[model samples]
Target: MKVVCSYCHRLLRESPGEAVGVSHGMCPECDAYFAKLWGGLKLGEYLDLLPVPVMVVDGGGRVVAASERLADVLHRPRAELRGLRCGEAMACSRSRLPGGCGKAEHCRECTIRRTVDEVHETGRSVAGARAWVKTDAGRVPVTISARPAQGFVEVTLDEPEALAGALGGHAPPSRR
Candidate 1:
C-alpha cells in the first residue's frame, strides 16, 4: 500500500499491506509547516490528517481530544466535544438512561467501550473490532481500531456511513 501525506499529497512510503494505526504519515516539509501552524505538531493535527472519525479518549472514556471529522459527525463544535463521554457523543440509547454512559447493561456488550477499556487497562492496540451502537433509529454497525497514545487512547472508526444510517441520515444529538 502506498502512503502519502493527506495534507500535502507528498508520498511517504509504500507498505506491503494495510497501514495500521492512526497515521497517514507526513513529509518532513509539511511536518515543519504544520509544526509552526499548530505551534508544534499535536495530536489533533495528526488526527486531522486521518480520513476517518477518530478521537482520543481518556481512561474514563471521556473524549479528551478529537478530529474535526468526529466533530462534524457528532454535529457538535470541536470544543464542546472535548468532555463528552464516548457513548454520549455517539448518542447511544443506553447512555441516555439514568445510569448514563458506561453504567448501562448494553455498555457491557459495546465493542467501542470494551476496546477503550482494554487499551486503557493494558496499553495495547486493538484493530478491526466491529461495534454495534444502539440509537433512536436503529443499531449502527461500525469497525473500530484503537491504540494507546500519549496518556489517552486513540480510537478510529471505519464506518461512519453505517453509523449515519443507524442515526437515520443525521448526526446524533448533542449531549444534554
Candidate 2:
C-alpha cells in the first residue's frame, strides 16, 4: 500500500503486508510548509502550531486565545476573537438568541460546547467529535477535537476533506 499526503496527494511512502504498518508521513514539500508555519512556537504560546483552526478556551467556554488558522477561518483578526464566548467567537447561529452561548436552548446538544464542558468537568481530552455550525451558506460540518493543556481546553477544528482520507473515506456529516 502507498501512503500519501492528504493535502498534496503526493506519495509519502509504501508498505506491504500489514496495513497497520503503513507509516503516515508527509512529502517534503508539505513537511516544509508545515515546518515553516508551525516550527519554534511553544504549545502554550501558540496553538497556531497546528495546521487546523484552533481555539483555547476556559472552563466556561470563553475564548482565551486562538490560532492564526482560526483567524483565517473566521475572517477576523485574532484580537477580535479574544474574550468572546466559544459559540460567539465561532458565531454558532444559536449564539444569536437572547440567552447567548451556553445559555442557549440548542447549546446543550452542541458537540463543541458539550466536549468543552466534559473536558472541564473530567479533565479528560476528547478526539474526533463531530459538530455542525450554522453558517450563512448553510450548516457546515466539522470534526472538533479537544484536549486539556496548559490550563485551557485546546480545541482543534478539521474540515471534512482533511479527515476523509484518514478516516477511510467516511466523511463527517455534510453541510445541509
Best by TM-score: 1
The residue pairs found clashing in candidate 2 are none
The top-ranked prediction according to lDDT is 1
**Model 1 stretches with alpha carbons more than 4 Å out:** 1-39, 168-176
Please write out the lDDT profile of model 2 over residues 99-125, one tens digit for every residue. 999898898888889999998888899
Candidate 1 yields a Cα-based lDDT of: 0.81
lDDT for every model? 0.81, 0.74
